[model samples]
Target: MKDAKLSNVFAYQNITHKDVFLSQKKYLSLFLNTIMNLESLKQLFLYHGCDKIYVKILSANDNSKNQVYLSGSYDVLNIFPISEIVADSSGDWKKERFKASVKFSWITDEGKITDAPNSQFILYPKYPEVRFSGFLQKSHNAPSELMSKRLPGRLLFMSVSNSGKILGYVSSPESEVTQSFNSLKHLEVAGVFKVLELELKINYRELLLKELFRIHSLGWITSKRLHKSGNILPCVSSNCGGYTLEAELGISANGYSEPDYLGYEIKQFKANSFDRIANEVITLMTPEPTGGIYVDKGVGNFIKSYGYEDKSGKEDRLNIGGIHKSGVRQPLTGLTLQLIGFDTETFKIRNASGSISLIDGNGNEASSWSFTSLIKHWNKKHNQACYVPSKSVKVPLQKYLYGNKVLLGNGTDFQLFLKQMLLGNIYYDPGIKMEFVSSSKPVIKRRSQFRIKSGNLTNLYKQSEIVDLLKI
Candidate 1:
């Protein structure tokens, strides 16, 4: 007798047609009808140790009237059992069959392991015959039904069986289907999916171009409108053009878990404008220093020693700003921003004399981060960032309206940024602003700013990916 356990076939050699001996004419006919499909036949062959098999349907009345089907060398088919017989019909020993849901597993040419559930099939005890039944037709519209259940990746194939029950359903995975399902789920929870499938499929440069086209389609958006309701406007920010391209690209207004649009940060500014970036300076994030002379001195003592009088009429403020070139003294604090632990002439960072360290009001030393740490943080926040340039036109009744023409910056070079900072193309402009109330002690606010020329932005980034907004 053939091995009853289907899994055992994988260990043995090929089995012939005679090996699949079935009894009873009704059972034989049912088995033949079910294995008519290639999928079902492939499953049967895989389980029966047959590289090549010929299935013959024998009639109980006449063996000469039997039919046959052949399956060629079967290395491409992969079949695996999912479940065992759960329950069976009551005590009728003469007629009984076991049912199971099967699963298919295969490794793609790309080496990706894909496993999916197949439909139900029956195993008869009287014979080595198994009947494959297609999935029940839950609905006539396959896409609509699968979409409703958020299983868009599942491809369902349905047909009416001889008994009129819907037969056959197979699910195939497509990246687009998965993306659509994820997008739909995001929309349901967050009320929006920031990027469409087309947007996600393209490269970062193409995505930026698409966003520029979308912005241009808006025609002219006024600065006043953009500033007053900047969150809703297509422009960046009223003060500096913050949300322009990002808003146009349908990104969430607030900073959250992910990047602005399709894993890329969108930064927009006017073309040829001196002050393109909204913030005058960029802050490099770092952990607080644990132990040092500065830490022992504390914030109050450090300020007392290095603090300079402010021209704004405040009692005393330690304001550090302006361009501090390598080996040159800063105008205000007479200190230079230097790279530590490396040679300045050859490396991006170098240590300098009289480097000032900061301490918070809570007496904790504010640690300075290395260029590597800063670059890592920046790249994490913006794996890909697009810098867009726009043209502004003045209007009589309305505020300035931006033109459709826009330029895009492809990618950023963190090493180049560090080099620029060392070369004085970027400057450290730290400041402290004090606010006083009726009877309360003055509120001291500190800020760390690294300023750079708006025109020098191109030097900090790689080649541009320019796309005409008017032409899309």
Candidate 2:
């Protein structure tokens, strides 16, 4: 299988101290081969109660010691959780990261499942990369033949389920599965791995579009919310517009970034008019802070330290409301948003211990959201989203009518979110409030919202489009 011309063309430095060279066409061909239909391949994962699937073709250097390289960006961190970054003494290699915790298993062609408890994903933020290892270490019934050595061209299909387990399947060398996947899969990416946005029965995007089209045919729906327990409740408030859309779609409220319907977040925005899908402030995410005074102290203490008194002539009330952008101080809160460990100019994480922090006047950390914490939420909810502009009615028994024209965004990385933050297209607007401030235990409601205008939304995704359900 060695042609000196091809071998010399793609030979890369093999880290295993071996004379092995993989072809440029191996990666190049896989990128362009999009005709392989993988419906059968998808059904296997679906049968295992998995919802999202990602693929990574092994390289000659992708071994246990070297680890499987994930990505240079924070996107893969969104899919697979990483352990806290352990900074070393020297800055030569930058940062070394490990998997937080994961349960990995191998599913055979016969549907047999075996656990690979040692399986872990490591991150090298120096290169700002992630790698895979431990799967073939002391594991039985695992793909030792494919993963144990410096093997190239073996396909790895890893899926994430609602239960948080990462299940995987490796194609046998020269198996028909690899051939079909190479020929028929969509050229989509998920972090370091290629995203398998399959045409399956569940995770397929077109199926969701068709369902939305069905709801579009319904004209309008009564304002109501579907409970996660499958109960229907009257949604008579401003949020009823979003609630009604979820109800019509038969989806239950799954908190932040958890897939709402068909592995996509269902977002309903109150549009002034649907003719152009008017610019509206969309709540991107509401992840709580994972560090600084927010975690060291309490939310009450943090709020008292940084928040301002309510300006609406309301007694015994405090509020923190307004826009907070990177490197800029907000007058009301008296805290500036700062991005640490990241080089916004290069769009890279120069340090793994980086964070989005709110620093107080005296240079104290009021609250900080670590890269590990934010990336988990950023793309999980935003990776794929369907933004539906809606108009609500309260006079006629409360109802919501969605526009036939919908905006569908796919393939986003947390890096895009950060990139937008750098440009001031996205800002942190908190609606935190404390009532009965003088009481023994004052009630506090915290809402940390990162919002963006609908017009600027396209900058966050790799592919975005206005879909007319009627046309479909």
Candidate 3:
């Protein structure tokens, strides 16, 4: 047997030390008596290689028999990215299955983490919520006492790692974790998640604001970006404002969809003044088409079919740029934007195959974004987004000065994005063009943007806060 580890630990990885494994009862006792507060629980999750720790307060309706209801809405998808869902034929009911490579475990008081191989996260698109099944099957030291009965208020914690694997822990109904859950339930994080933030004795909001103030103190900064190799490079593009902000924050974009800094997505947009922070159009997303002639035939062919000559009279160049709003026909492309299989009255998706499509005069789908495809990029990036306005000057070189008045938005839902699309607040404005058209292999730049004006920015989030750095 390995050396016996301590029953109580205040550090992050004290519970992770290899020790003589105790029985399930002793582990339960340790878990109940030890300092297993929310912060320590988060530390334990960190020790087990998880960055995104999502804890849910289990209700009476949430049980092993009930398949452990995750959420009633698309809130689950916002935190943890659930991949594309395909029809499941082996099931008795009409259901869909997706790729969830989660390896779950039940951590014991004996400092033992046992794996549950049969656990699965199921998604019912018809109800639009995710449920967990096959849990508690063939697992050692599993929490059968609370899970077997109809017990509410039990806390279920799922910790997702950088590799997309999930480690799970369920707290007893009468434990310290439960007590923390009840007291901190009022301060749950954005979406269906219930998190108790005792880290550094500073809440996430304060931490984010503190960092922003530090960044603002530095007046005009040179346009530069952080390389993945831990180096800084001179940035000279229209996107230099955002790139400079990220570089100042020391955020090296290694091609991950994680937040910019301190769990907040930093959005720096160009503006004339600080008062008109959201006056300019903000690009919500720029995902390529999942289906239609844009994907089936080719980008080149799609540009040739729908693209028009450059209005500036540039030779051998074709461009497709215009505002394509809901149910409106774009004159340049002659394509009308349509929403398929969505109930506008109910503001819900009636069909999983629904799409935000651009249709040609002949009713052919010129470009399309399926509901599943859009869900892949929606809400996963910015649950808590910080919008900073900046003014650029290009006299000697391009330099930007960030504004003191900043807007912070929290709690985004995919359906809310769709609702904005239906309300004509969100529209597709593509800057797709083909240069060197006379050459054998022409150069194509496809920028399919779904943008919204600054005035209507509050419609996308559940909460919005404007903070002035000059005061704080």
Candidate 4:
């Protein structure tokens, strides 16, 4: 029974009037025989509980010879407990009994079940083959440009290997589709895969510029109207602008998991707004400090040791806000955030200054980071950033002003950024603060920051483009 092919076990028949007899005894016998056959079929297939089923995915181009085994479960009848099938007690067997349907479930390494697998499998009993198909069509609701141009093909199977490599098989002759699957499988596993280049439908830069110009053409849009109408507006707060731009662009505003504003970070600021004066320093990231005197201390303790008084001069308040110039001592901490081991001119990190060292509380220098290491971390988040400038109008009722004239910062120049930092034009200012309410070690709000003057932005970025809001 275990070795029996599905074709040999399941039978299909077409009954005609001649096959039936009106005699009550004969009719009863026929009914009993039909039930017995169904029972036998069920027993043969579910003899081992039917909880575990293995799928063999073969390459159609290779004549179904090369294959990979993927563990899965069939959800037909009462075979799998993931869904239940109930029988009716009304004695009308044909209408009351649960209909048998084909369903398949595959468990991912992350313990997630792929969606709607039952509909994705196209079984060919005559060919004695079950092919998983229609994934590209069924899984994505993307623009046609982003969709595969080739004919929809059968999905072979995909599985994660023991070595953490993703293995996939597709029964398709289209090399492009198969190659795309191969290249994107790793991103798929991480759950952050997105084909933005295709999904965008148009040149991304052109689209963004067009949108920006449309906004600029409006002259001025009231913040009250934007907030009430749920429309896109240039927000005063950088944080608020980040969220508003996402909503305007039809992107989800909730998590860091997905790319922001279609694979680019949208940063809005008033014209001539700098990182320190505006308190809007570009935060590369918020990774925990790796080492130094700060390593042993908790965030609260570290703030207590290094924090200074704000304008109010409150006791035990830590204000990690001050100018950090290369070679020159920092204004607040008296320590320099120098480019020690890197060639300042070439923007390269050298082996001698392999690590950025800082003097600790005990007067011993501790290695903080090497230029090579920092650049790697920075590159991950700074891939593409859009800096926008806005014109602000004071709102008498609100704490912040309304930003109207939103201008685009075409692109960032990493090399210019390094050069600026070396020349004291750009600086690192950690805007961390500790609020001591009842003296239970205080609550800390840490904002790791890197700042540059608003006027010096041209040196760190490419030429600006003005977006006309009215046209969009």
Candidate 5:
């Protein structure tokens, strides 16, 4: 009768005697809370037209603990056709009340409604006081090692809040789980609200790392951004500062130097690898994150799309160079190698000079420069690879060879030059199948292209070419 549109009715079904009866007590309390209050009371009675209504009793351990839970079905019976119940002077109210009479019955041992209770109240509509109990559990915890990234392993816990918020969390050397069954075991004797894992103040970063370390057995990645002032924050750089490996959260390998990484100084780390440095920077900073680190997928794609000289109608912008031992020259302009998906092929020599090349199965070429006579004479004495091919194909003996071309160069090699191109490293399992198309062409087709999407360097957790490391 309150507001038909806003009000909802609940009905009970699945009345099985086998089910535990104690669970229904909570539902009964919730319903009373909604509809029982004196300020909103309304009631009416009838004698003749009311049909029979039935109530069932279930067995509890003791009669004092007994109760019947009412749902929306009771609302329909208690407050329908409100006009019939209002005590107006008009005779229509009296006539309507008489029309609403109903017979009452109770279920007995034989499961039949044998009789009704003797007393029944006939009255004007009014509400009653609603009383209920059993609120949820809320707790919090605090961690001391939040500022320092030095956890031995992962931890997990479960927590509940006074406002009925329940959270299951994991704290690892990376991320942690807090306030669950496992965490509860250690604090069983503590008061209802004082459990450590259930407490909410624990350092979530350490918690997550603890969980990650439990699973990975390695440390979580600790990347830091070096700001201008050089003050090391627990999180990554907020401004234009570059990223540095705070510590090897988990990854380890042979000969890998565990250098003390002071966060990125944009000036010192100008290499293209800075983009990945930014991504790991943001992931560690935000909690309950909405989005991810902004990356120029299109820029990488654009370079891949327009960057090379492809007979297949698409060019590879990032290419590897190949300089041959015989000193045969290839023109530098349209001569970039296809390195995007190559595995066995890698960059061996990225020299101090701007000229760059690849070392695939096909012989190498000084793919960025044009030949000069001084370079041709110089290559014979130095025992280096062939010189860069001339702009236009010319006599064989006059062609320039490597190591001498940079000595007589008129200007610095083009940063955007095809030879000084960036390289995209593609790593795969050792058994990955790959084949060279031809000596003249630098294309290696893999057995499957499915691995390409995930093989991008950005998706890679760590990257280093065999060329980047020192010989030691």
Candidate 6:
């Protein structure tokens, strides 16, 4: 039974009758499929027009269970460059920012052309659970229905030089499909889309290269696609479909100042067609410990993984914040507040909300009140002048004033919270240093942080008063 199971893993279905003296072997096929260097990429680039091209293979994975699987994606992204690449935005001196809508084209080995779309790109670390089958067992074989319906996709990246003279390409597994019911489920789901398939019906490589050529002709520097990597072998056992070859590659960014540049790593595999009665596509995957090759279903338990949740089309809550005067009924200015986690406990706010309200002890009902209303209420009740104290005063009012005069998003969130005052838009007309103070003060006398010829508030005297009042 064990030998029979082992035979299934390495089974090779015959395409045509041929007599061979040697017995079936799996390792022989795998050894022939693997490509360990970057020479191929360099060759592809030179073939197009590049004077010189650098190529490096980082890592790779391969698996076989009656079919082959390979996948790949590109490394181009609109990101903040390592050395700030700046451009004059119609007299606006904006810092380095990402530009959208860069397009590219690709050409295939057989002269086919294809279009490459543009969008955001991100590189993530690979997990360790990818597995592969060493040998197969009939009892362990995937169900016939599931095996018949599988369709796996391969991935690759092909690039051309900036001069439009050279082309480069790398291919690996993007992902795969497995199980008849599950595969059907994917097709049945409405509003769902499946990419163009490259398999039995089509000469996968020829189609892939043709698309690459299409992208190249369209002026795209490169094209990326998925493909299975392995050669077919003769069938050795009964009830065999054909030889299935699998290959996986691990690509990692080179440790350059630019974190975006990555090098490719490739692995190749070859196994008999009849090793197992599995389908063309292997959907569910299990990681093998040896390297990157992953095993499809017909194994054991599956685990859930966590990642970004889909919150598309969800409404966002309306929240606002700003600086408020001590006694003013109306807010001087207001801006929307962006929320972020501070510590595990409470939220640390860098700016005060423009509006204030008194809430019940239970934190339910809120009675709206403004700074001017509060001051009027206080003055009416006390019949004495109510002042929002400066830092010079040793009282709760002074603490409140200190906390209110804050400059946020100036280097760091915590720094703004600790330092109450902020100098706004230094590039524009140097304005007054906004500070927390009591009401009834003339706006013209507001102290200016940047020196300018103007009103008292903008004058040196008011500026001195502001510095003295804030104790800064």
Model 2: per-residue Cα lDDT over 363-394, one tens digit each = 99988888777765666667789998888777
TM-score of each: 0.43, 0.79, 0.81, 0.47, 0.14, 0.18
Collision count of model 6: 86
lDDT (C-alpha, whole model) for all candidates: 0.39, 0.72, 0.74, 0.40, 0.21, 0.21
Candidate 4 wrongly placed segments (more than 4 Å): 1-201, 217-239, 251-259, 272-288, 352-377, 393-416, 458-472
lDDT of 4 at 9: 20
Model number with the top lDDT = 3
**Rank order by TM-score, top first?**
3, 2, 4, 1, 6, 5
Residue 425 in candidate 3, Cα distance off native in Å: 0.9
Best by TM-score: 3
Off by over 4 Å in 3: 1-43, 49-60, 81-103, 108-110, 116-128, 137-155, 160-164, 171-194, 197-202, 253-255
> What tens digits encode model 3's per-residue C-alpha lDDT throughout 1-472?
0011112221223333343223233444545576666655665555544545677778887778887877776666656655344434343334434333236677654446787777766656556677877668898887877777788878888766544556677887788877866776366564466664422222457656766788788989999998977789999988898889888777765545656665677888788988876668888778889889999999899999999999999999999899999999999999888888666887766666678999999999998998766665566776778888888998799999988888888877777888899999999999999999989989999899999887787888888988898887
Q: Across residues 1-472, which tens digit of lDDT does each residue of candidate 4 receive?
A: 1212111122112322233222323434454455322222222222212312212223333222221112121111011111222222243322221211223333222222344332233222111122333333333221222123333443333332212222232334344434444444323121111211111022445555555555555554444213334444454553554454444444444434222453355665544442222333443444445455456555565655555677677766667667666777655664566555446655632232234444434554432543333433343234445555554445652122223333345334334455677887777667778877348657788665666654465564445544444434
Q: After superposition, how far is residue 46 of candidate 4 from its true place, in Å?
A: 42
lDDT of each residue in 309-363, candidate 5, tens digit only? 4333433423222222211232322233332211222222112121223222344
Off by over 4 Å in 5: 1-333, 338-356, 359-364, 367-472
Assess candidate 3 and give its lDDT. Answer: 0.74
Please report, as a residue range, the 10-residue window in candidate 4 with the lowest summed lDDT.
73-82
TM-score of decoy 2: 0.79
Where model 1 places Cα greater than 4 Å from the true spot, the runs are 1-200, 217-240, 252-258, 270-307, 312-318, 348-367, 390-407, 410-413, 437-440, 465-468
Error of 3 at 402 (Å): 1.0
What's the CA error at residue 162 for candidate 2, in Å? 8.0
Q: Please list the residue runs of candidate 2 whose C-alpha ends up more than 4 Å from where it truly belongs after superposition.
A: 1-57, 70-93, 96-100, 107-111, 153-164, 169-203
All models, RMSD in angstroms: 24.0, 11.9, 6.6, 21.1, 32.6, 32.4
